[model samples]
Target: MNKRGQFYLVATVIIVSIIAGLAVISNYSYEKTPSKFYPIEQELRIESAKVMDYGIANGKNTNDLMKNFSRDYSINSDSDSSYFVFGKEDNLTLAGYNELNSTTIQINVGLGEQAMNFTKGQFQAFNFSNTGENIKVIISNVSYDFKLNKGQNFYFVVSKNIDGEKYVATNL
Candidate 1:
């Protein structure tokens, strides 16, 4: 039989169940890791250009900017990114690779016979002269080619890993 207060009791139970489900969901989310890195890579690309410009205007070189940005990002973001920033006109090359960690990823930056590899959180510049040639990059076994424009043209390759998935972005 339907009682006057019975409906109110059923409604209250339904509301409480919904709220409890939401609470469980919220708690579960905080324990899981993401499976993608493109989102982080995109945000870095947008903000990094501004910072790079500021650094260049202040007479800072690409190598310096790359090191500083990598350091700053490691300090500010939960995710880690490996980066290679270089100008085509700059006759400098420094390349090193370290094992990946929670704060490190891998990227190979190359021009002709000159190749530089970087691990996240490690900043070392290698200097080599370019004889009017172009450079290409390989990420996750995929090769990409791009033209290098004239005069102080700086490029960046940022790579990150999440849940065994790797994502990379470039400002070319």
Candidate 2:
């Protein structure tokens, strides 16, 4: 081929390569931002049963356990008076007064969507027996931006309580 033709060919090749490189680089940069990312599975909701179980299992003191419950469930009940449990519907609400602490009611419920909606309501108070079954509770609150769906994005916090004692929170 002639020299001029060879020069033009080389120039054309270089131009094409530069354009391809620019495209790849732009895509790489766009993907690096956190707003572009998304999680695989749906973010799970904190179940009432898990919270009760955590409270029963890990709580160190009554106050501590109730604190965990209050924060996790956004409850306003006094620490010593809060109770949470899951069981039959018959013996759900039982209020008894104690001199050491305020009068506390005990209610046992299910661990499903209905219970979750109920707990998320205005009744931030809890009532459970301080006796046989030690209940533990785990709760997760997830919120996201405009683009991502509620469960699709991954900005969330988890709070777990056991026996009104050990409580822990984590971000995932």
RMSD of each: 6.8, 15.1
Model 2 weakest 10-residue run by lDDT:
144-153
Q: Write the per-residue lDDT of candidate 1 for residues 1-172, one digit (tens) a residue.
A: 5785898899999999999999998888454445454576577666666766787789877556655665566445544444443555445333333235323222233434333455445545555564344555554456555455664444555555666765555666
Q: In candidate 1, which residue pairs clash?
A: 92-127, 92-128, 93-126, 93-127, 93-128, 94-125, 94-126
Candidate 2, residue 141: Cα displacement in angstroms equals: 13
Provide the overall lDDT of each model, using Cα atoms, as 2-decimal numbers. 0.54, 0.33
CA shift at 134, candidate 1, in angstroms?
1.7
- Total clashes in model 1, counting residue pairs 3 or more apart in sequence or in different chains: 7
- Model 1 alpha-carbon drift over 4 Å, by segment: 1-36, 59-63, 74-81, 92-111, 114-121, 131-133
Per residue, candidate 2 scores C-alpha lDDT tens digits across 1-172 of: 6999999999999999999999998888432322211221121234433444565577534334434543444343222222233222222221111213222222222332222223222333334322222222332232211122221111222232334542322223
TM-score of 1: 0.51
